[model samples]
Target: MDQNSAVWLLLVTALVLANLPFIMVNRLFLMIKVESKSFIVNMIEFLTYFGITGIFAYLLEKKVMGHVAPQGWEFYTIVFFMFMIFAFPGFIYRYNLRNYLHKA
Candidate 1:
């Protein structure tokens, strides 16, 4: 495979590997537990969990990508976009689909 194809494969592989459980099961689990809570409470709980995960991912990347090199704004911009992309599914789940999918 060409370099571009290989890179795309790796990115897709990593995203699916990382996100499948969160998409299929973890959200279900959280919804069950958080259903009794207020929306803001649930949102804070969810965001805190993900924020910590993001911090850990950032730290791991910093180590793996090397510390001596200062990452550019483009790097953070990409990460910000990634965070938004990763959040889209959950946004749909909680805001758009939660009430429809699981009746109170």
Candidate 2:
């Protein structure tokens, strides 16, 4: 794939995966079902998705460019924040909006 397509793929993947922990089934990793999930559990799952997204991005970048670029702490910091922002809608819906739903 080309660099531009790879970049868009990574962004889209990050956006969807970032929300999975908050918005999907209580099951972890879409397996290992739980009766309920706590904040900490959700966070752990969220971080797992983040790691998955990172690996996916790495592979795509490597494939597109034939090498992986070195990244500094600042790059990671910004990317982390971008992931968090991508998750904002799901976070709000799960924590803030869900309670308001299912009410008469």
Candidate 3:
């Protein structure tokens, strides 16, 4: 694929994977079948996705641009917010949206 296509693919993949934790909790997705919806488990899963996505982005930058730039705390803060934004849809689906769709 072309460079632009590859970059877009990576971004979309990151967004989906990062949201998987929220979406898959309580068997909402077929691959996961966790019965407990504990806050600790969700928090850990979110953090794990954050770290994995960050590393993936870093490596993609290094490969595509041929160098990795130094980042500050502000950079991390922004990325964290972006990850949260990416997870927003899943959050709504699991909480508000799902409740509205119940058969009862």
Query: What CA RMSD would you report for each candidate?
Result: 6.1, 1.1, 2.6
10 residues in a row with least lDDT, candidate 3? 27-36
Mind giving the per-residue lDDT tens digits that candidate 1 earns over 1-104? 35465445545544443333334433433445322444455455555554555565555555555543567999768765675576566557656687688885
Which tens-of-lDDT digit does each residue in 16-66 have in candidate 2? 999988887567878778887888988998888989998998888888999
Q: What is the TM-score of each candidate against the true structure?
A: 0.44, 0.93, 0.82
The local distance difference test score of each candidate is: 0.52, 0.87, 0.78
**TM-score of candidate 2 on Cα atoms, chains taken together:** 0.93
23: Cα error in model 1, Å: 7.7
Evaluated with lDDT, which candidate comes out highest? 2
Question: How do these models rank on TM-score, best leading?
Answer: 2, 3, 1
**Alpha-carbon error at 9 in model 1, in Å?**
13
Estimate the lDDT of model 3.
Answer: 0.78
Of 1 and 3, the candidate ahead on TM-score is 3
Candidate whose TM-score is highest:
2
